[model samples]
Target: MKTRWIWVLLMTASAAQAEEPLGCVEVTVGGYKAPNYDCLSQQMGNNPEGAAAAQKNMEAMNVPVHKRPPNQLGLATPAATSTRMGNTFGTSVKPQRPPN
Candidate 1:
């Protein structure tokens, strides 16, 4: 009888786990937050069309960071980096002129 009860409890636990919904995740792109399509599709039972429509609706709701108008100081545009070398500790400070 104890063994049978243990089996029943295990089965019930597995059933509860199976009924739990899949975890959906969101991602930020171009300063816009959108639901992850792969996760959404899984949550929607792998329905590609439904996931696509949902993604479209989510994207339509917000303008991406790049598309927004420039700020008042025109600093919205990112600075261009022609050289890959970044400022290291040695180069960060200029050497003081020798007691000029």
Candidate 2:
């Protein structure tokens, strides 16, 4: 009887893990471009001690992430209000920006 209970529990755990077939979902950025990297680098202070540091820091942390708000720990400042993950698969797009 104890063995039966154990087997039942094991099967339950295994089935729980297999609940989803693991399909993929993609989020498309229809046409988003606001904070430009090239321009940002220039604005941040384009030079050895300025732009270089920013570039290195960005790369070190694996691309700059826009924060919704400055971290309470004071590690980073607030910028973008949201974030997401997964592959951004798409073709090369040459988008145009109108007068702002």
Candidate 3:
């Protein structure tokens, strides 16, 4: 039973190692190694078609400004009761009258 389990583990490990990433050319910059996105995109076939598909998907998911529903709770309106311009400051400075 121990030998069978060991054999199965080795086989699974080998199988996992056999499957490598299609793209992913590692880029080294300042001792930091990361996958080159451009190369990966090209290798994985995400150049133009993928971008277009993504854009279309985003557009489909988005709700246009004009099509959105009105604010039911009136949160969009100003909280202050006074409509005067100077009243916006909460009595910090009174609105001055023009001198004749």
| Candidate models: Cα lDDT each | 0.66, 0.53, 0.68
What would the per-residue lDDT of candidate 1 be over residues 1-100, giving only the tens digit for each residue?
9999999999999999888465876878999999877767667676669778989999987777788666533553332211222333235444334354
Ten consecutive residues with minimal summed lDDT in candidate 2?
80-89
lDDT of 3 by residue, 1-100 (tens): 9999999999999999888566567879999998777766667674668788989999987878676654543334343324433443465556444558
Candidate that beats the other on lDDT, 1 or 2, i.e. the better one: 1
lDDT of 2 by residue, 1-100 (tens): 9999999999999999877433333344667544445545554553568767787888776634563235643553323222211122132233333449
lDDT ranking from best candidate downward:
3, 1, 2
Give me the candidate number with maximum lDDT: 3
lDDT (C-alpha) at residue 62 in model 2: 69
Pitting candidate 2 against candidate 3, the one with the higher TM-score is 3
Per-residue error at 62 for model 2, in Å? 38
Error of 2 at 59 (Å): 40
Q: Cα lDDT of model 2 overall?
A: 0.53
